[model samples]
Target: MSRIAYVNGRYVAQRDACVNIEDRGYQFGDGIYEVVHLYDGRFIDADLHLARLERSVKEIRLGMPMPLASLKLVLAEVARRNRVSEGLLYMQVGRGVARRDHAFPNTPVPVSLVVTVRRVPPYPSSLDGWSMSAITHPDLRWARRDIKSVNLLPNVLARQAAREAGAGEAILFDPATSMVTEGAATSFWIVDAEGSIRIPPLGPTILPGCTRAAMLAEMAEHGMRAEERPFSLDELAKAREAFITSATSFVKPVLAVDGKPVGDGKPGPVARRLFEIFARHVKGAPRNALQ
Candidate 1:
C-alpha cells in the first residue's frame, strides 16, 4: 500500500507531494513542526500537542495556514490515509513560498502545510530503560530556543555524536554555565535522593516536551512530587536516577551519561514508577493489574 500525505489543501501520495523550492521552510528553515505519538488508535496527548502547535506558530509569527479544527481534521485524514493505527503524525508549517531572499516576503504568503503519517514500532512495553551519552557541544542556535523551529543542524550533529558513541540519546550541556539543558530531541530530568522529580523550567535552553508535562500530572496522581528548576550537570551525574522524555520515546530512563553509571548503573525506582504510571495512563486499561 502506498503511503499518503496531505500537502496544503490537497491529499496526495507521499512520493507525489512536493512543495515549491522557494518555500521558506526549505529555503531558510522558517517553519515549526510537531510530532505526536499514538497508542490504541488515539493520540497520546493530543490537547497538549495541539496547544504547543499553537504556541509554536505564535512564537514564530507563522499563521496556521488553516483553522486548528480544520488542521486536526486534515491530520486525522492523513493518519487514516496512511493506515497508521499506531505510529507518529508529523505536521509542519512554513512561512509560505516567497522569492529567493533572506527577509520575510512583503505580500501575504500562503502558509505551506504538510501532514504525513508513518508507522512506528509499538512503544516499548517494559521500558526497562535505555542508556545514553552526552557529547558537549557549543550552543550555536538562535537565542529563542523555545520555539520548535526546523533549523536543527546542531541537534543533528549532536545526535550523530551520540550514535557514534553508541548511545541512544545525546544530552547537551551549556559549556558556559555547565548546566544540563535537555537531550538533543527529548527533555531531560533527574530524580534526586529526596525523591523529587526535577526538570529544567521552560527556557531558551530546553524544548518543552508534551510527554514531560503529561508525566508531571501522572506524578501527582501517582503520589510523586514534581519540581521545575535547573540543576548542575554534577547533580545529574550524582542523582538517584535520570531519564529523558519525548513524544516518540515517551519516558526512557537513562542509566548512564558519558559512559559513567548513574546511581547503581540501573534504571532508578523513580523513573521506573513514572514510566509505569505513564504507561497506565496512556494504555487506558486500568494499570494492567500486574507487571
Candidate 2:
C-alpha cells in the first residue's frame, strides 16, 4: 500500500513528501516533535501529545501553525489515509524557512508542520522478565532537553554508544552529578528495594515522557507510589527491577545494566503490574483529561 503524509497544510504520498532545504529543522535542527500511538484505529493519549506539542512550541518561542483542535483532526485524517490501525503517528513543528543563522528566525514566519504514519507490530505476549544492557554515557546535551526539539546529535551518539555496548538502551550519566538522568529515547525508572518507583525529575536533562505520566497514574490504581528523584548509577544494580516507558515500546524490562542483573534478571512484579494496568488503559483509556 502507498503510504500517506501530511506535509504542512496538505496530505501527500509519503514518497513525494518534501520540505525546503532551508527549513530550520533540516538545516539547524530547530524544531519539536511528538509521536502518538494508534491502537485498533483509535488514538491513544491524543490530548497529552497535543499538550506537549503546545509546550514544545511555547518553550521554543515558535508560533503554532494551527489550532490544537485543527491539528488533532489532521492527525486523525492522516491515520485514516495511511490505514494505520496499530502503529505510530509522528508530527514535527519546525521554525518556518528563513535565512540561515543561529539566532531565532523572524517571528512572523509561519511554523512548518509535517505528520507521518507508520505501522508498529503488536505488543509482544511475554515481554515481561526481559533484560537490557546499558553503559553510562556523558550527558553533554543542551540545557533544554525538556523541549522535544530536533537537535538530536548528542542523543544519537549516546544511543549509538549503547548500541555498541550490546544493549537495548543507553542510560545517560551526567558528569556533574555522576548519576543516571534518563535513557536516550525512553524514560528511566527503577523499583527501589522498598518498592517505590524512582525516576529523575523532569528538568533540563529529561524529556517529559507522555507514557511516563500515564504510568504514574496507573501506578496509583495498582498501589504503587511513583517518586520523581534522580537515581545513582550504583543504585541500578541494587534495584528490585528496572524498566523504560515510551509511546512506541510501552514498557521494556531491563534484565541488566552494565552486565549486572537487575532483580534476578527478570521483570519485577511491580513493573509487570504497572504494564498490565497501562495496557488496559491504553486499549480503552478515557479522554486525556480523564487519563
Per-candidate RMSD, Å:
3.6, 2.0
Q: List the residue pairs that clash in candidate 2.
A: 129-267, 131-255, 132-255
Compose the digit string of candidate 1's lDDT tens values, residues 12-99.
9898989999999998999999997767667778888888889998988878888877887888888877778788889998999889
Candidate 1 achieves a global lDDT of 0.81
Q: Which stretches of candidate 2 lie over 4 Å from their true place?
A: 128-131, 288-291
TM-score of each: 0.94, 0.94
In order, the Cα lDDT scores of the candidates are 0.81, 0.84
Hey, what RMSD does candidate 1 come out at?
A: 3.6
The residue ranges of model 1 lying beyond 4 angstroms of the native Cα positions read: 129-138, 285-291
In model 1, the Cα lDDT at residue 177 comes to 88
Model 1 residue 78 distance off true place after TM-score fit, in angstroms: 0.7
lDDT of 2 by residue, 211-268 (tens): 9988887787778788898888777768898888899868888878887788888777
